[model samples]
Target: MAVRMEELRDHEAVRAVNRAAFGGGHGETVAELVAALRRDDPGALSLVAEEDGEVVGHIMFSRTLLDAPRELVPVQTLSPLGILPQWQGRGLGTALIRAGLDEMGERGVPLVFLEGDPRYYSRSGFEPAAGLGFRKPSLRIPDAAFQVFRLPAYETWMTGTLVYSDTFWRYDCVGLR
Candidate 1:
């Protein structure tokens, strides 16, 4: 029931949790992307929820960008937030998200964005990004699925196309068009 950030040594367990949580190619993508992000940005955080020695949930926040009308601004993105099927509905995922967002906010991250189920993310203060002047690169994303959350005072920084890390492009989450 306790959730906290995992150290680098616990990396494999985090991948295993992602594998079980998403159950497909997405898991593989999660594992690969996690590794690349850590290698590229040691400042990135990979979080997990551990219960009785097992990792039941996982989430990641790393450097990303907002491509505004004429320039790119640094931002951090929330991605691959997953709770193992057996652990779903227990609120571990929500706790992981709240913790990650709070940690980022306290550290002065101006904004955070994600692509996820609106019904779920909305409860955590996320609203459709397009409503905030942001756009998803892929049209496959439903309007309701792309969302952003900015501290009330920093909402101005959330606009424009989200540019994920190069790993995203390598894996086709970006530059796919």
Candidate 2:
């Protein structure tokens, strides 16, 4: 499978993948959130995993902010990574993530944060954000779920609270309920 930047033509496939990956009501919620993010966050980084011209997976990274002491540091947040149910365990998710991170790194994004399974995300170079002196935007986020990947552009001074975009709150996706 090849991972690449998502194009306008892949929107429906991306939505279908998200819905299939999450399933039921939760899938619908994620699908809606992704649509809203696409419309609201202009800086969102969206990637798709395609095989034989068929899009089977999707991932998104949105620009967020770090409330640092000196200034608000612009950062990226990875969320709602989805692979079609049949595509799970094929490493498409990892490929999309690595591609997204590489793309962000090329753009000089210092840090990428996400709320996910530590065991899974750690393989992609993500560590607990708290360990790096960054606070979660919500108390609802579990310690392990709040993870970060420091890119080459990252600086020690960038550590602080990660402020997610308003769309996340509007979707009630800040963290576990």
Best candidate (score: lDDT): 2
Clashing pairs in 2: none
Report the Cα lDDT for candidate 1.
0.81
TM-score of each: 0.90, 0.97
- How many residue pairs clash (N, CA or C atoms closer than 3 angstroms) in each of the candidate models, in the order given? 0, 0
Writing each residue's lDDT as its tens digit, candidate 1 over 1-177 gives: 887888877788888887878678877877787778788878887788989988888888988888887677777888878888988998998899999998888878877888888999999998888988898866777778888888533656447888777777776654213
Cα deviation in Å at residue 137, candidate 2? 0.7
For model 1, where is the 10-residue window of minimal lDDT? Answer: 168-177
Instruction: Summarize candidate 2's per-residue lDDT along 79-132 as a digit string, tens digits.
Output: 889998887898998899999999999999999999999999999999999988
